[model samples]
Target: MTTRARASTMAVPAQRRLQSWIKQSRGYLFIAPAVIFLLVVMVYPLANVFVTSFTQIDTRERTQEYVGLDNYAALLDDSTLWNSVRNTVIFTAASVVLHLLIGGVLALLLNEQWLSAEVRNFTRGVLILPWLFSTAASALIWGLLYHPFGTLNYLLMSSGLASEPVEFLGDRALALMSLVLVNVWKTFPFYMVMILGGLQSIPVELYEVSRVDGAGRLQRFRHITLPMMRPVILAISTIDIITTFGHFDLVKLMTFGGPIRSTETIAYYVWQTGFRDVNFGYGAAISVMMVVVLSIGVLVYLRMFTAREQMYGETTTAL
Candidate 1:
């Protein structure tokens, strides 16, 4: 090739390389802020927690003393920690199930065509009040309602619905359940809103076609509404389970894990260990365990949702 032609070819490659570099640099420039923010806000704190979990740090310590896995070992032998785990699981399970059931029912009720638009809107607005209130405020309000001589008990007594006032929050057997009820009351509205939004997005023609085919209400719900709402249900269930599992405010304010630690959730246990007992190292370990458990739950939820979507596709193809 001629010398000039060779020079032109080399220049073309150089120009292409420069253009590629510019594009790559622009991409990194767009992402750099988010990367820095996450490192500062999330990565650094998580790293500190991980480091602290392996040390014996407390109020008295200027520097954390490396204790290896002793904190984790102690947790294994701690009966109170086990009890907290059990309570956390129970609370999470009960709250998530009840929230889904109640919220699904409420969504169905509101989705009814016979309901006036204005009345439905008003009811939805009122339903969100519980969720709008602060968690501390909700806990306080519910705590009063659960009081032996509180308005709920008084009304029940006056109406002859109860033989006597029920010791809702004070009894060991009832404390966790009572907390679950309060949690459900405060959070189910959120699920209702999500499911209602999904319900609204569903094409009305499907329901109309089902009706024309002599499908009853139950049949329509089973075949149409439930199938269409599956994705939303899975999403909401995942969020509700995680939130309920880590719930601290309601349990802290209402029972303080009281009635003999009956409502001591994992989150509250972490708080107690870290702040109240000033055992920051052990608390960090527990927090790490919580992160693992919650991470597993979230992964499982995602897998389940994926499987459901695949099965739904197969069913649709089969039909």
Candidate 2:
């Protein structure tokens, strides 16, 4: 029972460990390609942007010099950056709120017991058409509608609502709201479809039981429907916030951040700064700032979700 016996015992365990490692490595092989792809496409570009943000780039000379936080510092005094930020917040908040309100109501109506299946299906299909169009396509269609010779102006003039063709996309005050309306129109259908799926997943028995207890439609909705749909609502709202906050294509196409840059969002500003103005370093800084803002927003939403759950728990306990 000396060195020979001890060495044999250790070798058996080491051999077993090797076999286990080999077994786990085989599973890792399947995911290795996906991991590499993400690193190449998403991670590398993200890291490059972060690096670029710290440097001053000369497009003419194809060179970069480390400038530390100068790019970010410059943003502090830039009135245009602040303006874009304010516009981005307004556009995102308005669009998300309207999407939720309109989508929720539409979902409830479509899920009504009195609605025939054919009518519901037809209405749903028609409503979802807006969401089917690509952003570029939506911009084109809305562009036509907002033009001086467009149907909207025609109707306003014919109905005596205006003495002239109202510049829907031309007026600075109306441009931002015009974009918001277009965004809401194009995106609410997605929220509606998501809420409808959540509604349908809810067990019918819950409604029956509530009705038997003399709960009215409003009561049932407050007690049962809302609680059940919370997850879907939270998910879709988070997505809407993130996407809407960084929205660019519509603004680019419809307004070009124009009317004295009234409709400029941070996203469009990044483009205007980088490609348009050839300030790649400053644009990268803006992009990094946007990521930070989006991260903070997601964290705040998650925090609210947690607090809501805790509040519900406390309420139940009290009840």
Candidate 3:
């Protein structure tokens, strides 16, 4: 080949490669702000937590000392840790289940054509009002509702449902469940909105086709709705589980982890241990353990996502 021809050929590919690199770099540049924000807000704090977990942080003395695995050992021996875990597990399970079932029902109901478009939109907006309220505000509102002479008790008594006021928060037997109900009321709207969005995305033609195949409402829901909503269900459920498991403020504000610590959770325990008791080392250990526990959930979610993607990819390629 001639020297000029060789140079020209090399120049074309080099320029093309440079252009490709620039295009890829532009995409990264767009995401760079988000990446930087995540590092500063999430990654850095988490790295700090991991490091702090191995150290003794004395707030009064203003000192931090490396203590290694002693904190982890203390956590293993702590009875309250197990209790908090139990409460957290129960809270998460009940909250997530109710969120899914009730949210699914509300989403399905809201999707119906029976309501006028304006009415439906207005109703959806009202339902989300609970979710938009700050957690502290919602907790305070529920605290009022749970009081002996509160609106709920007065209505119940006046309607002959109960003759006396019910101490919802003070009764140990009822405290946890009472708190769960309040949390569900506050957060279920988020699930409803998410599932409603999922429902909207479902092809209307599928429902029509199912009807033509002589499927009833229940059958259509089973065969069409449930199957199609699998992805949304997985995503929302994973998010809710983590949040519910780590839930602190509402329980803290409403019950103060009270009625003999029956409603105390992992997050509350961590806060008490680290902040209240000033046992920063032990609290950091609890915090680390909580992350390890939550990681199991994240792993499960990732596995489901991967499996779904593989199945979807296969189905797409086959078609």
Candidate 4:
């Protein structure tokens, strides 16, 4: 090969490398604005919260003084904080379980061939309406439904189910459950939509194969559908768990953590402490704690989910 030809070949490869570098740099450039926006909008505020958590600050004070662990120590001693923790846990668990179960069932129903395409689409469209509604609006509608002399109470009396009105939100016993039901109704459609997409992605051949092998409906669901849905369910449940734990709007609008703080959650507790009570330091501390707790919880849940899947798969294979 001539020296000129060799030089040209080397130059061509170098030019291609430069072009590739420019392309990669351009990709980063496209995302730079979003990254900067997030830093400005999200990271800076989070850093402020973390810093404020260690300071003694409130609406009454014009100045903030570093208080070290005072806020966290106070939080540990607070009974209401503990109560909010419990309520938050219960709310999250119930909401997630209902979201998955109801969403899964609805997805199954919609996936059925028995329903005509038009009927199925219309039903799905209706189911998504609740999710379409703003959280504030949904809260108001549910609030009316739970009113002492509202439609729900009137219906009960009309049907002779009860002689008088039921205090759905007013009574402490039913308040938490009532709020949970509303949260479930407003959010379950998201799970339904995601799971439905997962269901659609599942190959029809699996069910056909199972049927040809004389697998019953229950068997097919157990061995085929459940396994197929494991990943999708895991992802959906994780997102639901995180968001539900931090869920604020529905609880705030419906109950305001009312009836003696029976329905209080971490989100509401933080708001009440920071905004309403104006205990900025304490509220920031709680917010930080929420982040820590949620992180640990998600890790634990993922670990358990993976372990259970392994065990279940082994058992099924053995069977």
Candidate 5:
């Protein structure tokens, strides 16, 4: 081709690219405000914490000094930090597992076709009551139930299950587990709602077809239900893990990480170090570490989810 002809052809591609860029820019423009808001509220705070973590701040003197990784180095030798890490792991794991198990079972039961609409509706409303309560309110309610002379001890004593009141929130052995129970109670409803929505979205025809093929309840659940619900379960579990890991309010209100710090999670440690002890640099280091751990967990979950989705898609395409 001649030079002019080749140039015109190249210009045609450039013109198309420009038009495509303009089209994409409109979508970006729509989201620019939200993106800007997030940067201001979320990104700025996170960046500030990261910067603060490397400094030694003296609030009394109103001073900041670059201390390199001294804050993190101090965390390495801090036995309380290690203890808090252990507590955080136990609390997060137990809460997530119980939430999934109890929530899954309830969602399954509630999805049953034999249940009357009124009964189902009422049961759902009641089950979701826990999710309606704020963290502070949940702490207060569970606190009352767990009081030494409270309803739980009364029931136990009256039923001959115990000879004395149990110090649910005051005993080191029981405090962590007691807090776990409250966390489960308050958060399971979230899993239930998400799972229930997933269940409802499933086509009834799939179950009917399985039954016609001589599949039993367990078989149908294993093959049809589980595979379909995997995405929802994974998504919710990831969210639960992050939230439970950072949980603080219940421990703060009910136990105050008491009875020798049995319930002192990393989150509580951060607050204690920063506000109560007035060690802002150390607290910021702890906070940054938490963000790192959570980011790693979320990345793993996302990788698993993406792999499973790809495999499922390929399987569908093959069939």
Candidate 6:
């Protein structure tokens, strides 16, 4: 090759390298703020929680004493901890299932073009009001409604459904169920919103095509709607599970784990152990266990979901 041609070829590579460097530098510059923010806000606190979970640190203890795995061992023997685990599982599963079912139904109804847009929008607004309200305020309102002489009881008695007012929150049997109902009510709107978004993204042509092919409403939903909505449903269900599992405020305000420890979820148990019982080390252990449990659940969800998604392609019909 001529000297000039060789020089031109070498220069072209250098120019490309320079462009690559500039692109990488710009990408790093854009992400640097977010990386630093997460490290400071999320990573630091999470690291602290992890470190604390291994030590004996209480209010009276001025310094953390390294206790190795003793806290974890103690957790294994703690009946209250196990009870909290059971309750947490129950609460999470029940709330998530109910939320998905109710939300899916509502989303389907709202997505129907035959329904008036004004009516759909109004219902959406009304449903979302619960989610917009402060958790503490909502809990208090629900607590009042569950009172012996409360609106719910009054309505039940007036409707001849009950001879007397039922002690909804005070009764151990009823308290957990009542809290579950309240949680389902509070979170269903979130699922509804998510599912509605998924439904809106689905093409109208797909539904019309299904109908033209002699598919009934239920068949269309089973075949077309569900397949399209799977990813969104899985995403929402995972979020619902995590949120319901870790929930504390509503339960604390409504029943405070009730007459019995029936409603005591892991989150409340952690607070009670740490702040109430002043056993910081035990509470930290509980927190660690909660994290571990949630992590496992998330892993299982991802594995199962990914496998399902692969087995049945993204748009494969459920029917």
TM-score of each: 0.90, 0.92, 0.85, 0.87, 0.88, 0.89
lDDT of 2 by residue, 287-316 (tens): 999999889988898678868967886222
TM-score of 2: 0.92
Model 6 per-residue lDDT tens digits across residues 1-319: 9999999999999999999999889989899999999999999977877888888874664888889999999987899889889988988888988999999999888988888999999999998888887878788888889888899999999999999889898888888888888888887898999999999998989988988999998898888888889988888888878788899988788878767898999999999988888778778888888988998998898778878888876642321
**lDDT for each candidate structure:** 0.89, 0.93, 0.88, 0.91, 0.91, 0.86
Better of 1 and 3 by TM-score: 1
Q: How many residue pairs clash in each candidate?
A: 0, 0, 0, 0, 0, 0
Residue 105 in model 6: lDDT? 91
The residue pairs found clashing in candidate 1 are: none
Expressed as tens digits, the lDDT of each residue in 22-52 for candidate 3 is: 9989989999999999999999988998898
Clashing pairs in 6: none
- Which pairs clash in the backbone of model 4? none
**TM-score of the candidate numbered 5?**
0.88
Please identify model 1 stretches exceeding 4 Å from their true place: 1-19, 314-319
Clashing pairs in 3: none
Least well predicted 10-residue stretch by lDDT in candidate 2: 310-319
- The alpha-carbon lDDT assigned to residue 264 of candidate 4 equals 92
lDDT of 4 by residue, 1-319 (tens): 9999999999998999999999889988999999999999999999999999999874555889999999999988999999999999999999999999999999999999999999999999999999988988888999999899899999999999989899999999999999999999998999999899888887999999999999999999899888878888889999999999998887778887989999999999999989898888889999999999999999999888788988876322211
What local lDDT does model 2 show for residue 166? 87
Q: Is candidate 1 or candidate 6 better by TM-score?
A: 1
Q: Please, what are the lDDT tens digits per residue for candidate 1 over residues 1-319?
A: 9999999999998999999999889989999999999999999999998999999974665777999999999988989989999999999999999999999899988988799999999999999889898889888898889899899999999999999989899899999999999888988899999999989998999989999999998998889988888878877888787777888998778888998999899999999999899899999999998899889988987777778778778232211
Q: What is the Cα-based lDDT of residue 99 in candidate 5? A: 98
